[model samples]
Target: MAHVVSKSEMRHVSVEELRQMASDCRESIWAQAQAIGREPKIYLHWTAGHYGQFWDDYHVQIDEDGEIYVYGELDEILSHTWRRNTGAIGVTLLCGYQANTSDLGPEPPTAAQIEGMARAIEALADGLWLTICKEFVATHGECADNETNDWCHEDYGPRTTCERWDLEYLQTDESPAFNPWAEDGSRGGDVLRGKANWYHNQRG
Candidate 1:
């Protein structure tokens, strides 16, 4: 399980600084993923509440060898799945309140952050054979059949027609309202922006 940073801990850091940190973290995660030999896929939750709110935790990807594929803001991860974050890296951003709504008052991740995350997921997928829905069901139970619309419900099972958050959307660039950072300036904006270039350069 990846360690989630707290809001108090992130209070003083500048967006630029966080961005650099996110970059370094992503690099480390990618290297770890490569070493472990598993395709990396990250699961993100809007723990901080609604669009435009800032997040304080996130979940990351972990390779079979225990290598963590870290990406996105650290404060967005609400909690870990039953599988102990094993074979998957979990990251959490520190925003949002106990309520499901953003009324608690934290900014969500920015568009740039979301884009960066998308790129990272793409890279990890390209490098490894990823099974998003299978892993999600194995760990978090199937989405409810009709009880709750939450993707984490157990009844939903392996979705064949409907797209499960784990399997379909996270891997695609078309995810709805998916912003990777909280309002840009709240944390790590610059780093997320630079990740693609960094990744490209490193690949070369």
Candidate 2:
């Protein structure tokens, strides 16, 4: 069973308050796992660049044998990672999907909650001098078409294109100058590409 905490339950909490709540929640989770004779292993600390949107709720996946694996963003209020503190803010939704159902029910997070999260993320990014597109690209590698070669062949199969700028393009003169309004705007592409090339050549 998926457990979702209500927005109202967290609406009143400030960032500082939320941080405290996260600490409590983590402690409780650890205690419960220990009580049930399960060992806890956290694979990743809050990393920046991975946006915790789309899925509004945190989740614990339990296998057929009842082995549980927890996955989701740990609220920055509770975590001390650079990503959590200076780049990303966690927003949890209050509903869970059934194990087999790809479509989780309509337990959409409130507008206010979404807006609050956006504001928080913006503030964090501003503090760190990071933009949303840069963050996305950094976390997810080269946004190439999954079905074809890097040449972007569409006739072969479905093309997987990223919505943001492709930083890799800026590495060579083969890529055109960036235009923010263009369909393929290479926003920070040149800067990143140049930096990467310089560093690589320096090592050489």
**Candidate 1 TM-score, true structure as reference:** 0.34
* lDDT value, residue 199 of candidate 1: 52
Per-residue lDDT of model 2, residues 59-121, tens digit only: 221122212222343422232211122222332222222211122123322333323333333
| Model 2 CA deviation exceeding 4 Å by range | 1-91, 96-104, 134-204
- Report residue 174 deviation for candidate 2 (angstroms): 35
The lDDT of each candidate is: 0.34, 0.29
Residue 160, candidate 1: how far off, in angstroms? 18
Task: Return the TM-score for candidate 2, rounded to 2 decimals.
Answer: 0.26
> Candidate 2, which ten residues in sequence have the lowest lDDT sum?
41-50
Local lDDT at 13 for model 1: 38
Query: Candidate 2 local accuracy as lDDT?
Result: 0.29
